[model samples]
Structures are given as structure tokens and as C-alpha cells.
Target: MTPRTFSVVIADDHPVIQLAVKSTLSAAPDLHVCATCSSGKELSAALATHRPDLIVTDFTMGRSEGNDDGLRLMQRLRQSSPATPVVVFTMLTNGGLLTRIRETGVAAIVGKNEDPAVLRQICLDALAGHRQRLSPAIAGLMASAGARADGVASPLSPREIEVVRMFAAGSTVTAIAAYLHRSLATVATQKRSAMRKLNITSNADLVAYARDHGLA
Candidate 1:
């Protein structure tokens, strides 16, 4: 009898990274790359069409227009295909960001810097319904989520930081509000408050702050 094959749907906005993941996963005989997408939107459609056994996606997939597009995508997937396990494959190293992702109940959280083989193994583990695993980097971040220095304390709340990260990742305020399920006025207020707390007077400064803090 032929061995069973596990289908996977991989989503990332960058063409290069998408191709690289497809190539890496294709090397595994039992792991089939059934669908590849360039954005969270595309991934959602693919989920409806393919119903793959696993989902491997970037935290920043798709257009930056929807700042929380990636997070919202996860929500939709949880609602639509709760049985399929998800692996967050991202380069994000922010502890706060990882904490938020952890709340989504993903099966695995792997950093892009790790070997593709690590991801492959994690996928296998996830398919078997094993306990969730995190990369050492991610584990470290999770262990230190709210332990910042008093002198260097960040003024932005977790939600405000999320808004900044989304904005830095290219999401517009309108998109952010919709994704977060909050009113436009609320989103705008949070954005303005974040700016005020950070003393950022311009978009450029905000972007710089995000970059400096490894948010974007």
C-alpha cells in the first residue's frame, strides 16, 4: 500500500520566500506542497479550496493595507478550518508579537533563520497532533515578554504596540480598525495615543521607531 501523503498550504507575501519554502518542503516525499499563496487573502481562499492537512504561513503575509491581515487570517482559519494545524513561519522576534501569536493557539512557531529541516520536522510533529513546539528564539522571547527595564520602559500598551507593528507592516488605519473589529474612531484614537506616547511627530519617525524596536 502507498504511504499517506500530508498536504500543506504555504502562504507568504514575498515571492522569493514562498518559492524557497515550496522548494524545501518538496524535498520531503510524504509532505506535499498542495497550495502556495502570496498573501493571507490568497491563503484563505486556498484553505476553502484545498483543505490541506497543515498551514505554514508568514506573520506578515499579504498587502500591508490591512495591518492586522495576518492575525485576522488566523482568526478566519480557526473559524473555518479548526482541525487543520497552523505553523507560524516568520522572522518576527518581538516578544510581544510572539505572545499575541501564542494566544492564537498555533501548533508551531518557527523562525525563518532556522534550518528548513527544523520546519519540516515541526510540520510532521504537528500533523501527528503532538504538543506545540517553539524555536529557542521564540521560547526565549516568550519567557521574557514583560520584563523590560524601568528606565527604558516602553510607553505604548500592548494594543498600541500591535497597532504600531501593523502600521509599520503597511496596514492603513481603516484596515487596522476593521481587522481588529473596532470602530474607526477607536483605532484612530489608539494610533494617536501610541504616537503621543512615543513622541513620534511624523510617519517617518513612527516607521523608524518600529524599525528600531524590531516591530516591522
Candidate 2:
């Protein structure tokens, strides 16, 4: 029996990085670069057309037009194809960014400055069904959040808890509506209610509260 060829799509704003990644992956006999995109919109369009097995993208792209480019792309991919593995190769190693990426269900996170061999290994591991890469900083953040038990518990209604959990899970208002079988306006209302109950003003705060409460 013959093994299936793995098709990959590369999305990054930098042409040089895109070329480098394309060159690196091109060396593997079992891997194929199906498409290359320079923006989140292009990436989404390519994915819709090509349906690649894996997607490698940077953490930010100017083409997202003032949004967390890679994160938005990941969310779109999740909505369109939940099983396609995504590997984020970026220089953004901040704990908050890492946590956000993890919540978006990216298969692996590799530093752009890391050895190419390490990046390749991570991609290979992801192709073989591994998920979650623990950088020391991300681990420390997770550990600290675990130790803090000051988040809301037992007082919020089940709907409120669901709203908070979905919010922490990186679902936008529309996504939450779809997930909960509610209208967009209803979901937004629930989100606001949840925030008011927790006295949080931003998604980051909501995520932190959820993390502290072990809701994520």
C-alpha cells in the first residue's frame, strides 16, 4: 500500500519566510506544498479551494487589516475544518499570545528563530497526531493560573458559565451563537451578563477569570 501525500499550505506576510518554509518543506518526499498565501484572506481562500492537510502560518500578518491575523485565520480554519492541523511558526512568544494560540487549538507553536530542524520536527509530530507544545513561558503561565483559585465558582448560572467558557475558548459572538444554538444578539447579551456578573471588562479578563476558576 502507498502512503498518502500530505498537502500543506503556508501563510505568512513575509515573502522571504514563505520562500524559506516552502524550500524546507519541499525537501520532504511525503509532503507537498499545495498553496502559499501572503495574507489571512488569501489563506482562507486557498484553503477553501485546495483543502490542504496542514497549514503553517505566522502569528501576525498585515493583510488581516488590523486584527490578530493568524489568530483570526485559525478561528476561520476551526470553523471550516476542525480536523486540519495548524502549526504556528512565529516570533511572538509572549505568554498571552501563546495562551491564545493554545485556546484556538493550534497543533504546535514553534519560534521563528528556532532551529529549522526543530520546526520540521514539530510539523512532523503534528502530522503524526501530536498536539500541544509546551514552552517554558507558556508552562509557567499555566502553572500560575492553576495555583490561583480566586475565579468565580458556583454562583454564576449554567448559561453564564457556558458563556464564559466559550469566551475563554476563543469563540467570537457569532461563533458562540452557532455553538449554543442561540441568536447572535442573545449570545452577545449572555456574554455581557456573564461579564457583569464577573465584573470583567475585556475578553482577556474573562479568560483569566475562567483560567483561575479552572473553566478552561
Candidate 3:
């Protein structure tokens, strides 16, 4: 009998990074690259068209037709393709953000600084239904950040983090409220509450904070 092959979809905005990742994944005999996307929209379309067994993607892919930020993309992807596990490729250093990504139930996360071979191993592991794995750097960050890595002890609720991310992307409070189906007062309160937790006093600082955590 022929060996079974697992199909994969790779998403990244950078042409060079995309090429490198495709090359790495394609080198594995049991894996096949079904599609390569440069944006979240393209990725979604590819997911619908190919329905690959695995997804290897960057945390952020610039502005696309849909939500492409780290956490929102994960949420949308989960809703759209519940069975297809994901493997994130990123350069993120923020423990809170990494924790958020992990919570999204990704199969694995490999930092850009890690060995390229790690991606292949992670891909195979994900397809095998193995437990999730994080690169050394990501694990170190989570360990160093301690139990506070996630919002349970970290301060910002998942919804509040979404608000801050939208705000950083230039969405006005009213616009965010409308898009989120949240009342203006509630949106404002969430933003203020997030800021207060982070000790952010201004819009500029909040944006900076978001950027620092890869939220922007």
C-alpha cells in the first residue's frame, strides 16, 4: 500500500519567508504543500478550496480582507476550520501574546530564530495528533512570565485584548463598538480597563503596548 500523505497550507505575507517555509515543508516526504497564501483572505480561500490537513502560518500577515491579527485570525480560523490544526511561525517575544496563541489550540509554534527543521517536525507532530509544542524561546518566555503569561493572572481579558488590537489598527471606539456589536460605553470601559491594568495613560501608549505584544 502507498504511504499516506498529509496536505499543508502555508500562509505568510513575506515572499522570502514563504519560499523558505515551503521549501522546508516540501522537503519532507510525507508532507505536501497544497497552497501558499500571502494574506489571510488568500489563506481562508485556500482553506476552503484545499481543506488541507495542516496549516503553517505567520501570526500577523499585514492587512487582508478579514481579521488577520494574531488572536482574531486564530478565532476565525477555528470557526472556519475546526478540524484542521494550525502551526504558527512567528518571531513573537511577548509571553502574554504567546500564551494567547497557545490558548487558540494551535498544534505548535516555532519562532523564526529556531532551526528550520523544527517546522517540519512540528508539522508532522501536528498531523499525528500529538500534543502542542513551543520553540525553546517561546517556552522560555512563558516560563519566565510564569502563571501570569495568560490573562488569568495577566490582567487583560481576551475581549479587552481584542479591543486594544482593533484600536491599534486605527479603529475608532465607535467603529470597534459597532463591529463588535458592543455598546459604546462597554467598549470604552473595556479599553479603559485594559489601559488601567497595563498602566497605559494615553492612546499612543496603548498602541505601543499592543505593538510590543504583537497585538498590532
| Every model's TM-score | 0.82, 0.62, 0.87
Better of 2 and 3 by TM-score: 3
Top model number, TM-score:
3
Global lDDT of each model?
Answer: 0.79, 0.71, 0.84
Most lDDT-accurate candidate: 3
Compose the digit string of candidate 1's lDDT tens values, residues 1-216.
999999999988888888989888888899999999887667878888988999999987555443224556666677778899999998877665666666667888889988888888888999999987787767766566562322122457657876788888787889877777789898889989999987888988998888876688
A best-first ranking of the candidates according to their TM-score comes to 3, 1, 2
Rank the candidate models, highest lDDT first.
3, 1, 2
Query: CA shift at 45, candidate 2, in angstroms?
Result: 1.0
Better of 1 and 2 by lDDT: 1
lDDT of 3 by residue, 1-216 (tens): 999999999999899999999999999999999999988888989999999999999986675346465677888888888899999999777676678888888888888888889888888988999987887767887777763433432568878987887899898999888767789999999999999999989999999988877677
- How many backbone clashes can be found in candidate 2? 0
What global local distance difference test value does model 2 have?
0.71
The residue-level lDDT of candidate 1 at 175 comes to 84
Question: How much is the lDDT of residue 141 in candidate 1?
Answer: 63
